[model samples]
Target: MKWLKKSVLLIAVFAVGVVSGSMIWTSSANNTGLVDPNRPGSVNDPLITKSYVDQAVAGQVKTELEKQLQGQLEQLDKMLADKQKEMDDKIVQFQKQLDALISKAGGMTVVELQPNQTMYADPGATFIVRNGTTIAVSTDANGIPDVTGGKDLMDGTPIELNHMLIFPREGRGIKSTHSSTVFVMVTGGYTVMNPDGTIAASSSMDNSDQNETAE
Candidate 1:
């Protein structure tokens, strides 16, 4: 009877040892190396690391795209500024030409442009008559050339007096003969000087009888 009791106790001890070993094995199985390929992970796929890589690549791509777009926008801004500057320069040039045209008006030899005139270019530099005779265009009190006197006589401000030509009934004459500047013109027979009076330029004669002049 005693031998039988010892054998039964020994069997019970073996069973307990087997259960403890199995518990230890199960706890260690949670590691990456012990993961079962057949069973999917609870939080992530244990067999594939591609999901994390894709996310990282997508973030980098987005950053690069933003940088490229910013660069393009900056370039566009510079182009717009350049175009605007070009347009402004053209407008300024046109305004200057118009002003020059307005100042080129001349008057008859008998008449003169008075001080404080608003002059305009015409066939003969003619301005508003005063007592049937136009105002006199004169040099400055100290003998300086009075280029602005013509425009001033035409009801213009003296500050805006940069002008070159005066229109006459038949020809365009210069503002005055006081200066050495000459206005060469082709008249009835030959090239004629306008202000200082001398032939300077030439052109072929043709059927066209219209008065032609050269500066």
Candidate 2:
């Protein structure tokens, strides 16, 4: 029994010695700067500084901000491109409409005739005798069609002022019968001639007169 008690006491002392040695070695290692400041993530040096954490957070935030900014810039570029295309399309459409309106205007022209001046016109020519006395000229009995009066104007008939007239066939024309000058609005093709039959002015319209119906 005494031998058993001595063995148990030796074992107890060995345990206490081992615990004290371990604690002393750990304390001595800490005091001798065994913990590496360069390795902050290590268990022996687990402390993190405020500046390091701030730098890491700032880097992450900067990366995220750059990504967001790039995305926004790309979106803005696409939007701008779309708007430019839309504006270009609108410009093209507006140009087409303007061209159509100009073409449909029938190329109106105002012609002045001196006394005894004659104006010969092609088929589908429209005329509005505005001033002075004017007379219709035709080869056959059929003369200029008076759209407002709804009848064929005979040759040598004085055209009414401001009345719209249309020549249905070629080789039909009008002459200034008044002593003063005559002013006429002509659309389509026409040629003005002096008293000697010399051409004073001439113009040709490609399209036919659109306004030929009687009122």
Candidate 3:
């Protein structure tokens, strides 16, 4: 009887072990089935490594910075263009003013002198005898400058018709020859006087103003 009882106990322990093993194997199989073989590391999809997050953030920052820098460059180009245009406009304005000032300063006119009449010129006056006979008269020996002929005219030198003459200093003049009515084009300042040295007509000028009288 004792031997049978021991054998029965051993059989019972073996059967229980077999049943427990079978149940444990079934539970393990069920847990394995819950995990999809197709989805490997996707179990925790939201979880990412520090290196991967840093790379993603850096790429975004670089893109944003590039956009900002491009916009700044474009703005700078526009500002420079505007400034250049403004400078161009200022230059044009200054040119126009300069032209007007020059025109007013060196205005040209025609003067008529009768026989024995004299026309006294200020320094740097230009003259062109258009018609009739005339003669140069100067207080000093330096005389009047014949710009066209490239020579100087002393006192009583016959004025050449249609030649450009520049008076170098004050007290220099031209007198019409006897019985001739002289017509002359004049620039800068001058005064026409009758034979008695009385002023007939005069143009206003500053005595200190000097012009480049030579070509």
Candidate 4:
């Protein structure tokens, strides 16, 4: 009976030792909260120091600070752009005031460029105004000319060359055989005009004026 009691005591002692070790290990490792510093995740001993926690915290703070600084810089850029626009408006206003003052003082105010007027000065532009013809012109995004139309283009916007003024109601043609000849789009389809102004080829459109445009 004494031997039996001794064996049981030995088993109890072993069990208690295991439980105590586990508790200590869990407490040390759980407290390392910061990236398992102190090598707290080591299989041997676990537990981190204040230094590790501080370093990890510092790194996170630096990241957040950098993001904040970058946002501030973007905002600053937008502010500068707004300020620049305001300054430009002021300058334009001053120029107009100066022009008015000169005219009031009886001095000839030779205005070079007016706010409401634009001058075409491209030497390569062509001005071919037709008394009885509609104008066909190229356009930019929103229907404005990207490049200056011939010297004749009005500064405002381009008129689409989609109708009889430029196109053949419902026909195709030898757009231009010459290097780049502008074909006069005829309405009621394409009709090859005879020397005497007669229809050579008829497209048979009842009589609409939609036409092909230049690329």
Which stretches of candidate 1 lie above 4 Å from their native place?
1-18, 24-62, 105-215
Q: Candidate 4, which segments miss by more than 4 Å at Cα?
A: 1-45, 113-215
User: What lDDT tens digits, residue by residue, belong to model 2 across residues 1-215?
Assistant: 99999999999999999999999988897789885645777676788899999999999999999999999999999999999999977975674465345446866676667799899887898988876898998886888899988888888988898788898788888999999766677788888777887667677422232112100
lDDT of 4 at 162: 25
- Residue-level lDDT tens digits of model 1 in 1-215: 99999999999999999999998787778654585645776555555589888999999999999999999999999999999999977975674454345435431221222222222233333222212112223332221122435332222122222332333333322232222221222122222233344333322333243234332
Give TM per candidate: 0.30, 0.45, 0.45, 0.33
Q: Between 1 and 2, whose TM-score is larger?
A: 2
The TM-score obtained by model 1 is 0.30
Candidate 4: count of backbone clashes, pairs at least 3 residues apart or interchain: 4
**Candidate 3 similarity to native, TM-score:** 0.45
lDDT score for residue 120 of model 2: 86
Name the TM-score of candidate 4. Answer: 0.33
- For candidate 3, lDDT tens digit of each residue in 2-104? 9999999999999999999999987887688864544545554555789999999999999999999999999999999999999977975674465446546
Query: Which segments of model 3 are wrong by more than 4 Å?
Result: 1-106, 205-215
Residue 74, candidate 4: how far off, in angstroms? 0.9
Q: Please, what are the lDDT tens digits per residue for candidate 4 over residues 1-215? A: 99999999999999999999998877876786633544655755566799999999999999999999999999999999999999977976775575456546743222221111221212222222111122222332222222333222322323333221222112212211222222222222223332344333333422332122100
